[model samples]
Each structure stands twice: as structure tokens, then as C-alpha cells.
Target: MSEATASPGLPSRLLADPEMVSACAARDFAQIFQLAKRRGGFHPSRIARACELTPSRVGEVMRGKPKITTMDVIERIADGLRIPGHMLGLADRSWERPAVPEQRQPTAVARPVQEDRPVAAGASGDLDEILAVAAGTRVTPTMLRSLQASIEDYWRHDDEHGGEALRPAVIGQLKYVKGILRDTADPAFRHSLHGIAAELARLTGWTYFDARQHSAARGYFTESLRLAREIDDRPFIANVLACLSLQATYQDKAEDAVTLARAAQDSARLDGGTPRLLAMLYMREAFGHASAHDQAATYEAIGEAQHHFGRIAPSDDDPAWLQYFDHTKLTVDTGIALGQLGDATAAEPLIAEALRAEPTANLRGRAFHTFWLARTQLQGLKVELACTTAGQALDLAAIVESPRVVAHLREFRRSLKPYRHTPAAMELVSRITELGS
Candidate 1:
């Protein structure tokens, strides 16, 4: 590799990994020639001659970039000694492909003529009567559930259509539910409402964060905390706090993350013993300490997290939400903290183990682990692999409805720019940018 190929941004580890190098070598040179011909006006014959590959082989390379199985082709091309090889690998390796374009629905144009009309007498009469009757009925869980379901459906639709058309409806439903929850007097109803409110807050916060409207996300999270407090649902409260703490951590606010995690720990402590809650609290604290580069504190937090994990019993009657917290989850967090502490070698095995243990981990959890792995790979200068993993995470995050997942994805993208020219890294960056847009 020449000076140009040895750019500081390239992952240093790329040279050490036989698989990655082989993938580079086996990259299709045909695709590179075609792209060069189309974009740079390089003749295919010339490129083929330079790489010592037949024109037909060059063509095959072009078609194979998307399905290239070996990294050697890419490596050979990257070394700049093989013209056709360089062309093919470079063409498909520029960036990850953008998401498949969403199908657009046709809409009818409105007529220009407009007329204002008064409501009929019966319509006005019924409106007042209906309002009077509706005012007397208490807001029921069934009604709340209906609204919640509607919000969820709209969100799903938004995910498909970029959320433009459904955002207003989702926000409206959330506001209405919040108002109803505020006025309800029943304890059980309030508890259910609190759960609903936390979810809404998380979703709304995610929406705002996706829009880069951090202030709005902060407000929604604040409201979520308030609702969690109202019902005195300590476990749920801790969950909400964990979300907030993660937001701060991704924003590089280590102190804030620490404070929020400690608060969550205190809330969990009030309920006596809950292994899952303790694990969450300690994991969050470890993340904060890792961010701050406080190795001692990070290790201490990890120890606590491990202690909580050890406390879990097969026969314990844990809450439904806590069921996801297991040895895999703990290991994932440990890997994340270790990665942050600059121990990629130690971190990689832990992360791989976690992924294997929970192949179908929840969307948010998967995102967390993927982002951490990407970070670790990047630090070790494994640019292509880092980007690949990040791209996987972006796909997972698109389907996940959690603010915390979105936040982590955003951080992952930010961390990839140093090696943005690497095929995998570039691909990840483009995907995340498009998703945010």
C-alpha cells in the first residue's frame, strides 16, 4: 500500500485479518472497471489489461461486488498494484447501498374552489349532548389501550413512510393519553397509565432525537420521569432513568450519566432486592465510568453488575420486563465497558459470546451490543468490519421503537467518520444518514 492507501483513517487491523485481506483480494474487478468507465471514463480494456484479468472476468467482478465472499480481492485492489482489482473493489466498496426506496402512494389533488358551510341544526345539538355524556365517564384502561394501540400502529406506519404523515397523529394520541392519565383518580389506572406514559415518552423522545431536536427529547424524558414518580412504580422508574442515563452517556455527558444511574439505583434500592434492576443500574454506572476513563470506577461498577447477575435464581419470580436480563445481557454490558476502556481484544470475545448466546436479542439490546462492537473494532482500526456491524445495527434500529437505540445508532455513526472512505464504514454512514433523514 502506498501513502494514499495508508491513510490514517483506514483501519490498521485490516492488514492483520486474513479474512478481511482475502475479501479485499477476491473483490470483483469487473465492477470496478464498469464504475470507472461510467464515472471516470476509464476504458474497460485498459483496466482489464492493468489487472491482468480478462474483460469477462472484469464484468463478473462488477456483478459480484454485492456478493463478494472473500476479502482478499478487496485487499489486492486496495494495495493499488492491480488496476482491475482496484477498480472493482473500489467501485462497490465506496459506501453501503442506501435503503431500497420506499414505495410512494398516489394522492388526489384537492379542488381549488372552497366553500364554508354551517353545521346542520341536528349536528350541533348532538355534539353538546355527546360531550356532556362523555364528560361523566371515567377514562378506562381499555380506552387507553385503544389509544396506545393506535399510536403504535401509526408509529409502525411512520417507520415505513418516514413518519411524516403519521407523526402528528401519534403526538396527538400521546398528548390526549397524558391528559387523561393526569386526571384519573384510581391507583391501578394510574399505574397502567404510568406504564403507557413511559412508553410514549420513550417513543417521542426517540422521534425528537431522530430529528436532532434534543431539547424536545429532554422535555419528553422529563415528563416520563414525572409520570413514573406519580405511580411509584420503582422498577419502571428505574427503566425510564436508564433510558435517560444512556442518552447522557451517548452525548458524552459522563457526569450526567453517573448521576442518573445512581438515581435509578436508589429507586431500585427502595424496593429491596431485584437482581435485574441492580444489574441495569450497575451496567449503566459502568458505562458512565468508562466514558469518563475512570478504570477503577468502571471495574467497580462491572463487579457490581456481575454480583447482581450472580444473584439471579432460576426459580425467582422476576418481573416480565426483567426476564431479558440474563448472563448474556451482563456479558454484553461488560464487553461494552471494556471496549470503552480500550481493551478491544478482551471485549471482542465477550461481545461475540453475547451475540451467540442471544442471537435474537431484543432490538434495543442488539443495537447496544452492535454499537459497542463497532466502537471496539474502530479503535482497533478494523474499519470495514466496524462499518459492517454498524450497518447491521442500523437495520435493527430502524424497526426498534426505542429512543435509547436511536441514540446509540447516532453515536455509532459519529464514531465511523474517521474511516468514512472504507467500504464498510462508508456504507454504515450512508445508511444511518438516510435513516435519520
Candidate 2:
């Protein structure tokens, strides 16, 4: 198409404006979109269409959902908006040439993403949690079940995406559960509500741990333990202990982690531990051992974990929460423990196998397993492969809002210091730095 026939672009004056310049340099698309609207009389829809992005996506960018970072996306924006390559920190785009105007491919307008709480498919999505919370409506068994289902969804999303986004919702649910627990007169209601409260408190605590808010996490975890103890829920007590163990391991309190894991195992044993439960407990212990750099203890705990895991049959009556700790969990966990113990040679294949079994929905889990895989590869001196793997992990981690992933990526970055000059490592280092900034 001739220049005259082409859609008119943003005015050069707008692009040259200091605000525009700063927003571009900072890659603050939110400010950029708002500036375009306020100063250039451009609507988000037009910007989305011009950029081959959905109007909803443009809205999300304006709302600051996720940053536009991938090179392809940045380049596309450069071409679509007629923004100079240098403005986006890229080499000159072909479309910048006078003789080579860019071809703007059309993108289907995406429906705006909804933020409704998760409900089971085909079930009546009739539970108005927001309504109940506001109106102080009497809770029912059905509502409890609904909350349980939603809690499962919370865990699922927490695994897939990071927990930061879900924190508010979970805490709201926790408050609701606890409030109901306080006022309940019926034994059955009290029992059920107590269990739910314990679960919610523990879930909130896990989210705090993921955010690296250790103090907040421990407080919630202690609350969970207290609630479980109130009802003599041995299994739940064990579960909370396992959670605390993992948190302790992350905090570098390896001895405490090991002791907590042992206590969890003891509690599970008192409750006639399911094979899967024992397996998970042992895996927690393995993590503790690995963190302490106790190679012998680490392998022993890993062996025990795998041994128990192998005994788990399809018919076993494990706790609902233990359902998440399946074969895939054990595989990835074993590999991580091994890697942490400096036996990366034996860890890489296991992590890879676990990744293959993982559903794409679990983005954070994939990021985590991929990180271990990359670390193992690096340990084996496969620097380029490690860099590529780490890059993939970071890409998966980027959209997820977990500082835990960021911390892990930082450690990975430090590990790559020796190979910092290599192209792959340099690219990864740059990518990691960009993510931080």
C-alpha cells in the first residue's frame, strides 16, 4: 500500500515527547498507552489493532498485568506502532525503511479476561462468595463443599501461576471460614469448619512462603497447627508440619527442617499414614538433608520417599491434598533433592521425565522443575544447554508473580558467573537483569 493509503501513525511530536520517551525507555506500556490516549487522541482499541494485539490485552497492558518483554513482541510493537527500533532498544526494524512499509496482520479481538472465582464445570456456579462475605450469610455444608472445591482450584492456580495474585482471595476465604468457625453451634458444622479453616490458614501460609514472607508464613502455619490440634486432626497436623519443614529448608534452617519433617512423619504414622503421605514426608526430609549438604542422609531419605511412593496403588485412600503428590511430584522432587546434594548427574533425566508428565497448566511447577534441570545441566558443564534451559525456565517464570522463582533465578544467574562471557550465558544474564529491572 502507498503511504497515503496506509493508516496514519502516532504524531512524531507525541513520540518525541519526554513522557513518551521515558515510558518507552522504561518499557512502561501502561504509561505509554495512557499517554497515547491523553496526548495523542489514540484509543486503546486502535493501539491494540495496530499492534496486532487484542483490545482486552491492550487494556491489560494499561492495567499493568504483565510486561511486554519477549523480543518478538517488542519488535512487533516497533513495526505496528511505527515506533523506531532504537526507542524499544532494538536494531532498526525493516518497516522503518521508506520503501518497506510494514504489513499489519489482523489479530482476532480477544474477550476480556474475567476474574470470577473458580467453580467446578457443570456444577451450579451459584455460590456467591463475594455476596456471602458482604451479607454475613449463614454458611451451609454445600457452601463448605463449594469452598473446598474452590480451595482445590486455588491450589491448582497457585501451582500454575504464582500465589501473589491469589493471596487476597485466599485470605478473604480464610477470614470467612474462621468467622463461621467461631459462631457455629453444631458439632458437625464446627468440625467441618475447623478443617476448612485449618486448610485455608495453611494455604495462606504457603502463599506467604512463596512470596518469601517468612514471618507471615510461620504465623499462618502455627494457626493451622493450632486449629488441627483443636480437632485432634493428626493428618492435618502432619501436613502443616511438612509445610513448615519446607519453609525452614528455604530459610536455611536445615536442622529445623529435618526435625519438622520427622515430626510430620511421626504424626502421619499415628494416623496410619498412607503410602503417598509417607512418601511426601520423606521427600520433605530429603529436602532438609540436601539443604544441609548431608549426601548420605539425603539419598537415604530419597530412597525412602521413592520406596513409599512405589507402594502407592490407585485404590489407596490418601488425603485429598495428597492427591497433588503423585508420581510426577515424586519424580521432580527426587531430582531436586539429588541436585541439591550435588548429584546432578543422576538428577537431570528424572527432572526431564517429570516435566514431560506435567500439564502445561502448571506453569510455576514447570518453571521450578526446569530450573533444577538447567542447574543439573550446568553442573555437568553443558553451559549452552544450561543457558537455553534456564532461558525457558525464566520465560515460564516471567508472567508468574512469585518472588521465589525470582530468587531461584538469581541463584542460577550467580552460578553462571564463570561462563558469563558465553553468548548463551550473556543472553540469559541480560534477560534475568531485564526481568529484575
Candidate 3:
């Protein structure tokens, strides 16, 4: 028998190997495709068509081309093939392929040995040691305050400096703070750590969201919420809930988005009100309504969000995590809601202002705004501009290793099919389509 026909069947092997079985049962398309292709006999062309992929893509995958197949694409392919979705490795809807572990490089600082002794209760013992360690590592109150100020500055002027430029420093400080928190044993110290973790998670989520790695972003947001809950930090919990609501909206889970947003609002209400959190929750609710095509509800929510946001006082003691909320952020979200509501005309000015207000360094936000602009332009039949904007978004997306950004690009490619005959549009679409290979 020829090698292709002689190979073991996926079903038999799936029953034997736990990993393969688990992967199959989870509807993990990447693993299923890998195993199926290895077994051979099945024609690549047929598989490609079944998966809604181009014939060329089948050849690339069969030939082991250097391409990244997104989990969503794999799920779509599995759906198309009428495979038992659970067998394809989608058991955990939140399952994500872990990022490739980075090689550990030697650090400039000396590493400390892990201690087994439990920290003594109170401000003495381990707490004192932890504080001393933090001080040695320059993680003092002054340092944290300064870092916080820098982060705020970065957010405020991200349009000018570009988001990438601030990432290294922000991540560095976050890592440093995380280490300090993890090594501490005092209840008060742990509480402070929880606050820091929540904030870091938010930043990480934003970074991942910008990169278009929705799954990873969701994971970070989930962790952030967990941290806030551990600390009983009501405002932070509401903020994290708002983040989750946005994720649900983006993934087309409109009802879930609304539910989460309302929950966030209620949580904030119980905490005596946080205008920023309330505004974010209302804005997300508006987006959810827009996604559901409930125009009246969408408009009502948007008005509520705007009124609350306007009521935020400069003198009010807002939580550190809500520092990013501003008029510019509101405009961007409003534009997105308007676009979803099918009011492209109304969305245009707000999107434009958002783009103009966004810092050049905020590459991720720029990419997002540009992508939405492309969507709006495409809906309006401005094919050339849409193509150009999508191309720009693709360029920015490439610089960040984000799955969420990739997903957006994938959707944008789908929306560009009507203009595939146009060279510029087709070229842009081709690049994004190539990702699934």
C-alpha cells in the first residue's frame, strides 16, 4: 500500500492517544488538520473548500508553509467539514494555544533563592523583608506613583508617541511590581498587590486587544477581575467587567455583552458610583444594543454614557485603573456604536476625531480606528480608501503579535470580497487570507 493509504486513521489514533483525543474532543482544528494531513489520502483541495479556504491555501498547509492558522479559522473549517466539533479540540471555548515560551536570558540583577518559611503575620517578618526588597528594586511609593503618572501621560499622548514606544517601560514596571507583590505575605501587602495585578492585567489586556489576540486579552481581563475580587476592589471589578462586556460585543455575543455591562453598572452603583466605570458600562451596553440592531436602545445607552462621562469631575478621586477614560475615548466608542447601528454618516466625524486625537505612538488604537474607518468606508462603497485603510491597519497589526488584531483583519478581508476584482482591494485581501494557511 502507498504511504498515504497505509497510514493510521485519525479516529483510531484519537482513541489511543489522550492528547490527540483531548485535542480532537476540543475541536482544535490546528491539531485535527495536522493529524489528518499527516495521515494523507484526503485531498487538500477538498479539505480547503470544506474549510472555506482557497485552493492555494490547501497546498500551503499540505506543503507546510510558514503560516499561522487562527483558532477561529480552524473552528470554521471543522464546522464546514461537519466534523464533531468537540472532537476537533474546542472543549474549552476559552482554550488558547499557549504562547511559545521565551528562552530565559541572564538578568543583570542577582536571583534570590526561593524561601520555604511562611511569612509572619503583621508588618514585621516577611512583610519587612518584602518591603526592603521592593525598596532595593526601586519599587517605592514614589516610584509607583511616578510610573503611574508616566502611564497616564502615555495614554494621554499615545497619538503623538505611538503605543509601541511606551510598551517596554510599562511592561517593565508592571513586571517589577508583580514580582514585589508575589513575594509579599502581609494581608495589606497582598491587597496592594491585588490592586497592582488588576491594573497590570488591564494594561496587558489593552495591549493584547490592540494586537487582536482576543483570546489572550480575555484571559488577562479574567485574571484582572479575579484579582480585583480578591481585594474587594469594587471599582476595579466593575472596570474589568466592562472590559469583558466589550470583548463579548466584539465576539458578537450581544446579549451576554449587555448582561455583563449592566452587572458592571450595578456593581459600581453599589460602591457609591464611579462615573468613569458607569460611562464605560453604558457605552458597552450601547455597543451591545447596536450589535443586536436595537437602534432605540443603542441611542438611549449612548446618551446615558455621554451624560455620565460628562459628569466626571476633575477633582474626584477616580480609581487608578480608570485613568484612561477621557472625552477622546468616549468619541471613539461612540463612533464604533454608530457604525454598528448602521449610521456611517454619523460615525465618520467621531471616528475621524478619534483618529486625530489618538497619539501616533498608540499604534494599536490607530490600527483599530483605521480598521473601523475601513469598515465604514467599505459600507459606503469607498472601495479604494477602504482598501488603503485596511492595508494601513494590516501594517500596524504586523508590528504587534496580537490575535485580536488578526481576527479583525480576517473579518475585514471577508467584507472586501465584493471588490476582489479591484487590484488594490484584492491585494489587501490576499495578504489577510494568507494568514489561515
Candidate 4:
């Protein structure tokens, strides 16, 4: 097998040692650090920072006084140290293989995206040459355009098949694009790269949310916001904030949802997004208010959304990302808000209309909207209709791979207890049981 390259100042023998490479790949930091300090002239403090650990902690691990736990910390250390993910028993490193064959770098060097320093703990020789060689593999606008296309393609797949099926691949793509961003130099290109990175992060967050991985989703959303701020991309920031708020709404954190939605709307107003984008934020605010049981505020926000949406025109400057927010989407969101606020009468027709117009390509969305429509049916005491509508959602759920959809179906099953004597309800219950949680 070909040996991995050694960090500057580290002995070639260490990198070549099978045992040492195995320790690093296994994330046995204690063993790796012990060997580094004794045989590689490595500095603990520098390694500590690279791993995002305190020097004392690094020492404790080296001395076997403490064990490094937490997959997050381990992954960070492996990434910061430029340990190939495949070596660490994870996916291939973003640099080891390009996301697309055309974007591959010419050099073998794989640098960390965040830190500019070399991977060596204390190496100090000709760092500029390494960076220059790495930078020579420039990411042009055409390359970024391909990346954007890939992201859109993933979105389509996520819409059809749900996030669980695509999370690993989408995240891998994000990592690869992020690596490219690190090597980019042109100011305009870097700014564009940041925009794409922010969107990728946001998409990753959405996928995590769909998978019911709330903590992971929140982390990615926060990262997206930070990347958006780096480029001062207000529209992207607003969209990310709206996504956070939507997650909060789904989790029943009404106050947090309202606060985040308000922030998103404020961001859009201050930073100048299109009317359609502003409308989408307003609709998000409506959902937050509905979740809070604030009927007055919910309708008011819904009205605002309608007002803003009415201002849209064919000549509007909406980006391609805003294409998902058309009239049908507005109707679906409004119906959801109304349903949440205990207005089944008003919500049912609107939701049904949107569901009817929903294309077959958007299976995940159709499942989601169907759930709301069933909820509205249940609210109206139409148990038979509700059971049938929910059955439709359950059928879709069986095909799509979203934890959120499963969660909704589970909740729907629980709601059927009141109508257990009804044959339709019992039939639906049997189907749900067969589907499994």
C-alpha cells in the first residue's frame, strides 16, 4: 500500500509506520499523541488547538488520564488534522476524491478548510509553497455553476425521496465544495463560493430536520447563517433564519419560532430581498403565530404574506431558489397555519386545492400537505375522511424516507384512538401498525 505523506518536521518513518497510521485512522488520539510527542517532535498546544481541545485535555489523553469521547470532537480532530475520512473509517476525504471528476485538484495536498496552518503540530518550513501549490487548483465560476446544479439536483431528489436517502451524499458534496472555497482567492469568486456554501449548509440542515435530527439540523443552520454573514448575503440569511423558525414551529416551540421568523422578516426588509421572498418569510411568521395560538397575529401575518405575494410580477427579481414559493405553496402554508390555529373549515379547502395541484414529482411535499389536510379533517370530526386522507399520507410515507413523515404518521395513529370503533379508523390503524414507526 502507498504510505500517506508526512507533515513537515515529522519523521518519514512515523507516517510510514502501519501502527501509527492505524492509530490515527482509528481516532485513538491518546496513542497518536503519545507517539507524536515521543517520536515526531510535535507540540501539544498546537495539536490541541487543531483538535479544538485544551492542552490540558490533550495531555490528559496522552497520559491516558482521560479518554477522548464524543463523535463530534473526534470528527473535528480528524478533519482539522487533515486525516483522510476513509482512513478514519468514515467517508472518503473531500480532497481525496472530487465531488465531480472535473473539479479534482492537481496536487496531493489536502488542507483543512478553516485553519490555514499546515497539518504538522510544530512544523515551520516553506508553508507558502504548499499553499501556493494548493491554490493553483483554482475553482472557476464554471466549476461553481456545476456545484450549484448539483445542489439543485439533490434538492429534487430530496423532494421526491426525502432526506434520509440523500443526507450522506449531500453532506459529502458540501464538504468538497467547502474545500474548494478554502483554496479560492479571487474576491468575487470567493463571495460567490460563500453564497453556494451557505445554501449547501442550509440544504444540509433541511435534510437533517427531515430526518428528525434536530441538534444536527440546528448546527448546520447556524453554520449557514455564519457563512451567509461572511458574504453579507441577506437573502440567504433570511431564508436560513426562516428555516430555523420552521423547525421551531414543528417542534412546538412557538415562542422561539415567532422570534426567529420575526428576525428573518427583519433581515429581508433591511437587506432587500424580492417581494416573493419577503412573502415566504411572512408566511413563516404566520405559522409561528398559529403555533402560539395567537389567532389575531396569525391571520395578520397571513394577510401580510398575501399582500407581499400580490406585489410579485413577471419582471420580479426573484432568484431560482424562490421558485418553490409559488401560489400553490402559499396556499399550502396558509392552510397549515389556519389548521394549526383550529380553523379546519378555512384550512381544508385551501389545503385540498394545493394537494390537488401538487405534482407527482414532489412526493415528500405531497405527503406533508396530506398530513395537514387529514389533521384538518380530524378537527372537523370527519373521522372517516380523516382516516382516508391520512391513509394517503401513510402510503406516501412508505415510499419516501423521511423521519419527519414517520413522526407525523405516528401522531396521526395516536389521534385515531377516539374513533377506534369505526371500521375505517380501525383499518387505518392496522395500516399504520404495518408501516411501523
Candidate 5:
């Protein structure tokens, strides 16, 4: 019921109005414009300022000359006007909250971690104070590139250290980028910003996914997808879809996972995405098929995945996001898909090779892959070896606070129920229990 104090976001009363809610739900911007004008003293110029629309565009919308269909613009309006995300089918905007007092502003602000150095973490009241003091500056290409580099750093840190600690920074940066997007007027600059925003959302969602927070993950993935569509970026769209598909697989929504993965494939194929990108999508599809218990379809998808991967050359212009999907990743994924089909004997060697080559920095990935390897080993009746492998996985998982990793380790422990009396099983169980406690 609180209004956005620093932002021009809607007041509780107007946002609560049935008619305003109806307009937002329908995405009827013209009606929204009229209502803001009538109820909130948001005249055409104010609406233009609040929503990041040109005055002419605002006029057109007011006259109902053009219906607003662009997702990015709609999102800007929603944030600027302070409409809650539920009505507009979005994740809650960073600005959607009660007004904070000036005395409390400094404490509420938290900046995104943009460099290698550690910084304090909090919300945008911090940004507002900074932007207010540095208002005349425009976003530079250098600035955008810097932000992108930070994203790559985040990915590296996340891979090695897990996502739990990075979650706050990731979300804070996402909110920051979105704030930058509002003030940036140049189309070229906005386009790049939108890409950053999309990637950031995906990363934030990924952090949530790592924590086994599927609902939060889905929301940010959806946000990323919408932002990608805003710029008609097919590769990014496919990436977000693939993220959703993988989340669905983890959530046990097998059929839905397949549907989402196929949709990602369609998007990836549209622009003739890089071999690596297509390969990753196919792997996701394979995961979905395997989860669905469709052995033949799973193998077919894995074949396609490898086919595309084989085509990847050094000169292939792959997106930065797909850089993590190298040969080791492909091998492990293939193993996992095979394991899903209950082919543990065949899956074992493949996973072992990949685990040996897995980068030391990729602790989380290594832990996850090791879990699958242990699963395969257990299925093949190598109980002692499985226990050893599971111990390694548990140690790695313990190093990084990943709920998904812990959950898998817990599941593996439960699987060891039959052999709980064995020395290897007893040792592993004791270690896991100590860690859990």
C-alpha cells in the first residue's frame, strides 16, 4: 500500500483503483495515460518524463492513435508509474515499494558490485543520491562494456564460489541497469542496455535457480525473455527459454520442460545461432526428453547436440553467455542425459573424463557433475565407488552454498540407505550428516 517515495511510481490509491488495475492488466497504455493524467497530475510532459516516452509518443497514445505493444516501453511505464508487477504480468520492479524517509535513505541504498573490489550492498536510494549529484552524465559505450565485463566476472565467481553470495549483488546490479535504461534516450545505447538488462536478469534468475528457488528463478527468466523480445534478440531469447526449460526439468515438469526447450530451439534456429548455442539448446532438449522417460527422443536430441557441437569452430562467433559450454560441458551433459535414461554403465566413463578435465574454479559445476557421476556409479552397483564420488561432491558442495547441490547430495545419501551398514556408506553418511547439521 506504500508509494514509491523517490520514483514517480503510482500512489497506493491510484494503483488500487479498479479501472487503473484493469488498464494495466490489459496493457492499455492509452487508458493508463489518461488515468495518470486525470488522477495523478501526470500531464503529457510529466508522463513522458516518467515513462521515458517521447512527448509525441505520449500524445499519440493519449489520442489512442497507436497502441503500445513494445514490452520494454511498457515496462518503463510500469516502473515509472509505480504499478505493481502482478497487474502487468511482470516481476516486481525495484521501485515498487513504500516511500522511505530522507533520514533512512542512505541506509536503504545499495550499489551493484561493478568491479573486483568489495563494496557495500543495499538498494537504489543509494543510486538516486549518486545520480542526483551526477545528473548530467550520459551513458557511455565504455560504461556499457564495463558493466558487461562485470557480468562475465559474476559468472566466473558464480561458477567457482556458487551463487548464494552473488545473489544480492546480481539483483542490485539488475535494478541499477534498469535505472540506467530509463534515462538513456539513444536507441543504440538503449539497445545495448536492454541486452545487459536481459543478461543480468538471466544471471539473477540463475542465482535463484542455484539456490533451488524455482519460483524466483522463473520470474527473472520470464523478465529476461520479455526484455530479449523487446529488442528482437533471438539468441538471448533462446538462452532465456533454455534457462526456463532447465528449471522446469529440475522441477520435474518434464513435458513442460520439453515444450520450453523446443521453443528455445526454434528461437536459436531462427537467426542461425552459433553452433555452441544450438548445441546447448539441443542438450537442454535432451535433458527434457530424458526426464520425460523418452529414451529414443533423448538420444536423438543428444545426437543433434553433438552434431552441432562438432560444427563449432574457433572462428565461430559464439555469444559470451555460451562460452561456458565447451567440450567438457557437452561430455558431462551427454553423460547426464544417458544416466537419466538409466544407462549408468555407459554414462560412467563419459562423466569421469569430463570431471577430470573440469576447471578447478568451477567448483559448483564440478560438484553437480560429480553428483550425476555418483548416481551413475550407484546404478551400476559400484556402491563403494559411488560413496567415494558422493563424498567428493559433498565436500565441493559444502564449499559453496548451493541448495541444488546440497539437495542432490541429500538425495544420494538417501539412495545409500540399502548399504548404510557398509563402511564406505557409513563414512559418507556421517560426513553428510555432520555437514547438514
Candidate 6:
């Protein structure tokens, strides 16, 4: 593609070149790195930063000394470079879709995206119809099954779009489910209903957190934990506690964060949760430790997380919430931990890779990670480039109503104070002000 036709904010100067595009499509990272450095005037470090790899790793690839065999890494490189997905043997490119509006509720006509995983097919319709149909009928297993599918639909939508857009719909369904719990006379189905309620509460809490409503998020988390405890769902409790720990970390309450994270780990120590779930807990612990600036403890937690994660197999009976915590997410969390510890050299590439690996449909997540890249860029003294990167994140922030993004960007603006005298910095400040206005 020509520069004129390339996606916005992409490294078009490189990606627009047909030869480079072909190399990316072919997964020839060595050639791509070489050409980008020689012809594109990008340093190996720049390439490493863009690809989220260590300089040594980039050198190994360029020298053909290290095997570039991991599909995850290849996908990250492809994604970071904005290579067309079809060029990389993927079915679709993320940039093809426009930003989804937050207010668009799922309807009867909503169709599921075809993927390898199980999803609710034809689940785009409103739940009011389902409720209307089941008005006089008793709570049947089939009804619960349909509700479960509906819950999955909202979950998928929240992942694709930001929580702000899908919160109302999810809340509506949740309220309906609570009504069922109140009216249903069957004791046998109460546990199942409670399980779904806990899930709904957790999702709601997550959305609130995503939106930066910390108080509400914490309240919902508490409710979810209570419901999970009522059901004796140790795994679910562990997950919710981990979430609380994450919130605490974000809030800068390091001690509380660490305490909650450890509690989560202890709650599931008896194989009550899947290995992947335990790994997630350990990852949160790492985050807490990193936030507290405890380097040794941080790395230890990360190692433990990886240990548990390495034990996961395709047959593991993990929960739905654990689906997004794969190798890619682990890499992202590790980068964030390292970044928090002020190790920009070690953190930059990993953060870059995570940004590339983020799905286009997940605009909110992309925006959040992009902010991190800009933050890292600033720390590395790449002022002009950092502004440009921050600008891209700002564009995304304009489209997504995420309070977390808003908070992060504001903090980024504060970071630019030292560079306020520079033209680029001033211009960026002006743009950010305009964004807020």
C-alpha cells in the first residue's frame, strides 16, 4: 500500500514500501529489520522498540542466529509494523473496522464473529424479549443456558468495545437475572443463578474500573466476592480478589495491593482454580510488587506466574475470564511491571510488542497500552516521537469514553512539563487541552 492508503498513525514510511510489506507478509523479520535500518533510517534500537524485542534479540534475528519460531512473536512484529493481516496469513486486518459507538446495543440481528472459540451465535438481540417469553414459565435449565449465552455475548462485546458502551446493556441483563433469582422457587438452580450473578457483578466491576469509577468498581467487586463466597466458589473468589488487588495497585495503595494479591493466591492454593487462573493471580502480585518498587519481589512473582502459566495446556479447564490472559497478556504485564520499576531499556520493547499484539477491536486496551508506549518514549528522552505516539493515543481516546485513558493521558501531559519549552511539546499540550475541552 502507498502512504496515502495506509492506516493512520502507522509507520507508513516503512510499511508503504512494497518490498518491506512483502518481507513482513513472508515473516522475514531479519530482512525487514535490515531493510528498515538501512533504507528507512531506523536504528536497530528503534526497530527493537517498535517490535518490542531486546536489541540482542533483534540482532539475533538479523544475524539469523536465533530461531524466530514463536507464532506469538511473529504476530506481534506483524501487528506492530501494521502489516496487513492477510499478508501475514491472517484472515482479517484490525484496522478495517471503524470505531464502534458505545451506545449501540446488541439486537436480534447481531451476528457472531466466526472464530475457533465457542461464542453465543445470533446473540445480538435484546434480553427483554427473552424475559418476556419466560414471563410466566418456571426457571428451566434451558432458560439458564440461554442466559449464560447472553452473558457471553456481553462479555465479548465488552472486550471488543470499551465497557462504557456496553455497560447499560450488561446492567440491564444483570438486573433481569437478579429478578429471576428473587422469583425462582427452585433451590436447585439457586447456585447456578448465584454463579451467573457473580460473573455479571465481576464484569460490571471491571467496566466501572475501566471507566475510572473506582468506588463503584470496588463496590461491585465486593458484591461479586460476597456472592462467590456464598457459593463457596474459591476460584471465583480468587479472581475477584486479584481484580481488587489490581485496583489497589492502580490507586497507588501498594501495601493493600500486595496484601490482596497474596490473599488471592492463598484462596486458590488448593487447586481450586485452574493453573492459568493461578498464574493470573501471580501476575497481579507481580504488578503489586512492582508498584511498590520491590524489584526482587516483583521478579519473583513474575517467575512464579510464568511457572504456573507454563503448565497450562489446551485441555485445562480454565474460566472464560482467563481466555485473554495468554502469552501476549503475560508479556504486556511483565513490560508494565518493568516499566513501573523505571527500567525503560528493558520495558520499551515488551510494551511495544504488546501494543502491536493488541487486537484492533480492543480499542480501549490499545489506547491504554499506547499511552504506556508514549510514557516510555518520554522516559527515553525521545520527546518528538513521544508526542507523536501520544497523539495517536489521543485520537483513540477521543473515540473511547474511558476514564482510565483520560487519567493516564492527563498524567502524560504532566510528564511533558519539563519539555514545555519545546515546540512539539507545546503543540502536544495544546492538542491535549483541546481533547479535554
When superposed on Cα atoms, how far off is each prediction in RMSD? Answer: 25.7, 24.5, 26.1, 20.2, 16.5, 19.9
Q: Model 1, range 213-247, lDDT digits (tens) per residue?
A: 66887888787778777766677678778777877
Ranking by lDDT: 5, 2, 4, 6, 3, 1
Candidate 6, residues 235-320, lDDT tens digits: the string is 77889999999999999999899999899888887444667888899989998999999999999999999999999865454555
Query: Local error of candidate 2 at 74, Å?
Result: 58
Please tell me which predicted candidate would have the highest TM-score against the true structure: 5
lDDT of 4: 0.81
Which pairs clash (backbone N, Cα, C closer than 3 Å) in model 5? 9-82, 10-81, 10-82, 109-123, 110-122, 110-123
Collision pairs in model 2 = none
Tens-digit lDDT string for candidate 5 (1-437): 22324345656898889999899899888898899889877778767766655678789788876566545556677766768888898887665556586564455668665988654435677777666658633676457657877998999999889888988998988888888888877664687788899999999999999888888999999999988888898988999999999999999999989999899989977876778899999999999999988999999999999999999865454555788899999999999999999999889999999999988888888999999999999999999999999989988987887889888888888999999999999999998888778
Per-residue CA lDDT of model 4 for 320-348, tens digit only, reads 67789999999999999999989999999
Model 2 CA deviation exceeding 4 Å by range:
1-137
Model 4 clashing-pair count: 0
* Cα lDDT listed for each candidate: 0.66, 0.84, 0.70, 0.81, 0.84, 0.78
TM-score sort, best first: 5, 4, 2, 6, 3, 1
List residue ranges in candidate 5 displaced over 4 A. 1-137
**Deviation in angstroms for 235 in model 1?**
2.6
TM-score of each: 0.57, 0.69, 0.59, 0.69, 0.70, 0.67
**What's model 1's overall lDDT?**
0.66
As for model 4, its CA RMSD to the true structure in angstroms is: 20.2
Separate clash counts for every candidate:
28, 0, 32, 0, 6, 4
- Candidate 4 has a TM-score of 0.69
